[model samples]
Target: MATKKKPSSDQGSSSSALDSSRWEVSCFWERRLQKELMSLMKEPPPGVTVDAEGAGQNLTQWIIQMDGAQGTLYEGEQFQLQFKFSPKYPFDSPEVTFIGPNIPVHPHVYSNGHICLSILTEDWSPALSVQSVCLSIVSMLSSCKEKKRPPDNSFYVKTCNKNPKKTKWWYHDDSV
Candidate 1:
């Protein structure tokens, strides 16, 4: 027997807010993302580069390029991460995933591009920023010893939620 999870009161209200003022809310987040993008362009972190995808008119989605850090199993390898931000950003974490043809095979990373990192889910805080998330991901890659998938890779990839942010991930392993 399985138990059903209850939706939080906050979720309900946020959904209502979205339904009521969808355009206004999206504009607010877009401006915020634009500001962050400008700041990032001025001073980006090492081994990480970000740009708006498509015609650069939308700030809601971005493409991030990351180079594997030295001394890691993925050294010299490059990867692309796609981040999709919702109108409730800062309050809601972005949907981040490895994109393109070269996805890294890491224990916490799914073949479908979903990453099981805690910060992107349960551990997410409104205080966390895009820059911080990039740093965290780079650090995760840096600490990995072996290039491989999680123990339940095949199963998880087959049945995992399309939106990783909706999944309830178990993050017991912190060894990376």
Candidate 2:
């Protein structure tokens, strides 16, 4: 059997190792997020507005406000979405959710703010940007006919992961 080495007490080896494993800022993603932010600021998408909620501080999180399309069930209503990016963003999808006093009662939106949009999950591609995600959400909301929650909303809300990104969503229904 191989011998197990004791962690060195002087170096606080175990704690140091754990610290190193913790998430840290990535220059690559930071630059990308910054560029995206600038583009959004310059020319925001229709029906959507984006801003860094952690202004002058963190850059990994963003707040998006969306207006329902004119001819949709949610028309004239407004909703807010929060997006949290990880160091591996672009390669990994952001944690997106509706953070609202008025979360939309839509077939794909949960009462607890979790959204079941495929692009935010399985359909995500690195080529997708913050602007595209916002537009996709707008399109999702625009395409809805009736204002209602998901069929399994209550059950899923009660037993779902707090981080929407953790759930393995099944994209079976396209007629949202």
Which one wins on TM-score? 2
lDDT of 1 by residue, 53-145 (tens): 441456678888999888788889999999888878877899999999989988889888889899998888978878989999999988887
Candidate 1 local Cα displacement, residue 27, angstroms: 3.8
**lDDT of model 1, residue 155:** 92
TM-score of each: 0.81, 0.81
- Cα misplacement distance, residue 35 of candidate 2 (Å): 0.5
Poorest 10 consecutive residues by lDDT, candidate 2 = 5-14
What tens-digit string does per-residue lDDT give for candidate 2 at 1-176?
12343334332223344345332322556556766776787798988887544521567788888888888888889999898999888789998999978899888899999999888988889899989988888888888878898999889999998999889898888875
